[model samples]
Target: MIPFDLHTHCTLSFDGKSSAEDMVRRAAELGVKHYALTDHVDLGDHADPDFDLEATVSGAKKLLPALREKYADSIDLLYGVELGQFVHAPELAKKLLSENDYDFVIGSTHNIRGYDDFYFLDYKEYDPFRLLGTYFDELLESAETADFDVMGHITYPLRYITGDFGINVDLSQYAPIIDEILRALIKRGRGIEINTSGLRQKFGRIFPDEWIVKRYRELGGLILTIGSDAHCTDDLGKGIDEGIAVAKAAGFDRIAIFKYRKPTFIRI
Candidate 1:
């Protein structure tokens, strides 16, 4: 498998620490064959007050061309976005997708309607089960209607709920809904990303977990991508080898890379 990481963040993201050039350079140095700068473009009322979509999109557009050329010998740098909350503002999402020639767009739901990001929520104060139910419902909606190449971190809420709070979630309860989400993605020719960020965090497993990956494969979902979800330079391509192992274990002979909004599979 080529060392690649399709999901990552840079200074353009509200929570990112490294700059785009820095992250891309680091990926090149690490021998990453394919690297994507998928910074956060989280939208809707639940989005951070400080996030500026126009600036983020324009800044990336300006910075990427030079960086891509500079690292062209070492890396294939892709300009991508982790677009969160597509269901919240469908028209705005459409507008953003139409305007920017994003090489990849990851449809994600950081929070449900009328709530903060799962990272900020006090799990003790809310019903985790209810939140997960809503989260999966929103994921299904994103799968059905969002303009994206892949669904980012399908079990995102668990990163905080179970990883931080040590709460054990009964994933079986959500299986039916998850199947619906997977089916929706497969039907639309969309994909899911196996986010490796959890491996370095309190969570010791990948996002969506192994069973989910296997299930997606079994359900005839062909598109799968792996990512570190790195927010800093040191974390670039982190755990990506392990992510490939997970993909292989899940029975995927090939993984995907996107450019011009079309998937090109790379054999693992």
Candidate 2:
């Protein structure tokens, strides 16, 4: 059984609906042994213009100790943040990492040079293929530049590929690029995540595709984490069992957990 959910969002996140205490209570109820609260931090001002970056970091620091004390015995709660990559905001990204001691840091490519097809509301002219290719390139660059503990959803742009966008991801076309990204992550000692939230979306699969996971293993990338990316209590632990099955099928014998920014591998 997969006992840890390393990527999630609580009230600290702008889109998060559940409080930290609520998430802890739900995790305990579901018999989850470990988890992390990885809230979204958009580097590009395009996603959420009203988000106060400094205040978000400050709030996260303030809540960590109490939550840690509250759930210390029953469940292990980790402090983390999900940073969106813009490449231009590398300095801000580094400053956040330097100032705090986070248990985990998730680097995600939410935009390609200030235009995010996924979260942007007025994305009418978005080209899926070009956006995907650009997103992958930016992700690889961010992995090299950003000092994050883990790379957030590897193939995040897939969520917006369907519906009105009329984009279909064949995976075979982007396999080599994804392999290069995974290889870069491995070289930098960063980990990849099995974002279960993707299953709830139209793609009906986790990030990076199953083939990416297999290639990651083939390239000696062992560090992996599973996340529901839940905004509410009910979404907690959703589709994680299937995620574990995917990981096992991809030849991963363990899942990585973080504590005070250090990784500890637990056998699945």
Candidate 3:
């Protein structure tokens, strides 16, 4: 069973449509013991400079307490954020993370160095290999310096590169750099998440794939979290059972959860 969903987006995200209350209620119906409401905050050149995190944080602090009390009996609602591209805005990232005591923080690179979001880019206009190389480069920068609890959807852009662009890029060429990213996270005592959104998407696979998870395990990286990256009610809890299976196949015995900014292991 998929016990908890560690990565989810609610109304706080520009693209998300569901409210936190709705997400938690849906989790209860789905028997998800724990659920995280991880909205987006992209500070890199890709994100709008006008993005207001203070307002979002304030709104969350206001509603979360009541939600927690209401769902106390049925679900564990995790208040979290998906902070993207912190390498481009380290100061702002630190300020937001320092000021807000989040239960979970997911660091991701949704925007490349030149493109703000992978979704907005025209994959046909660029070489897939070079573009993906730059993608990994930026992701490494985020993993190397950002203060986040888990790395969300490591191979996110490939959903587009492989599916939309119909280009097959070999991951072996980037294995060395990928290992560096995993080691960096390992050294910091951080974690990597098994994001299952791609399974429902055209990618038909989880973010980071199986080899990446196994590689992290080989590097002695233990903390693994699972999430659906759901943006709507219907997508909630999607692909999570498969995610746990992937974790087990990668040789993980448990999944990690964050509470009060610390890691807690839960048997999968």
Candidate 4:
């Protein structure tokens, strides 16, 4: 098992099944030395009504510190959030980040402008390639400006487009955009994550694939993080060992853990 998980969800997230306390307790039981409860905080046009940004961040802020103290002896629980669609609402995103105290933040773009999350979209109605182009462009914008510790699930669309719908996507078509996104992240000293949730889901692979991970390193990007992106206690840390192996293959000897929005590297 990996020693830490940087992205995870609890009851604070709309789709989460387990409570924060239960999730933390279970992480300790499984010998996870470092962990984070990175519940979703979606923003702007695509955000649903159920995900109250203030409530989610405040709840995590109020609850996690106490849990961190309670489990101080057994686990190093970090307070974190997955801040989605930061490009859509720059002022709101800046305000939220400035006001809150978060140990880690996963920057993501769940959908393009005026569209639902890829998971909820009807694939038959739209051109997947066009949608992917928009997604990467939006992500590049987010990478250029969003304040985040790491970019979450860079290949998120493939989870549905290829994994669920069985549409074989030639990502090489978007290589230029992908390179720009990676360059933006590297220029700003931000990193990308190897999200392992895809391994268990229909995708059957880590997000962004090994090529992107290696390319990130090749382009002078030094920071990388691994996460299960687990939404429940049972799924926490799942496929994390495989995530580590991928990181190693990508030429990363150390992975990052965030505290106070700054990165600290630890050997894998």
Find the candidate with the highest lDDT and give its number.
Answer: 4
When 1 and 3 are scored with TM-score, the better candidate is 1
- Give lDDT tens digits, candidate 1, residues 1-268: 3468999999999899998988988888788888899988888898999998889888888888678888888899988999999999999889988988888989889999999999999989999999999989899888888889999999999999999999999899999999999999999999999999999999889998989999999999999999999999989888888888999999999999998789999899
Q: Which segments of model 1 are wrong by more than 4 Å? A: none
- Candidate 3, TM-score vs. the true structure? 0.96
Clashing pairs in 4: none
Off by over 4 Å in 4: none
Clashes per candidate, residues 3 or more apart or on different chains: 0, 1, 1, 0
Show the lowest summed lDDT stretch of 10 residues, model 4.
Answer: 45-54
RMSD of each: 1.1, 1.7, 1.4, 0.9
What is the RMSD of candidate 2? 1.7
Over 1-268, each residue of candidate 3 has an lDDT whose tens digit, in order, gives: 3589999988877778899889889988999888888888888666866567667777776777678888999888888889888888899899989888788999988887767688777877867788789888887887788899988899988888886777777899999999999999999888899999889888888998899999999999999999999998889999888999999999999989888778888897
On the 0 to 100 scale, the lDDT of residue 175 in model 3 is 98
A best-first ranking of the candidates according to their TM-score comes to 4, 1, 3, 2
TM-scores, all models, native as reference: 0.98, 0.94, 0.96, 0.98
Q: What is the lDDT of residue 37 in candidate 2?
A: 85
Q: For each candidate, what is the lDDT?
A: 0.90, 0.80, 0.86, 0.91
List pairs with backbone clashes in candidate 3: 46-116
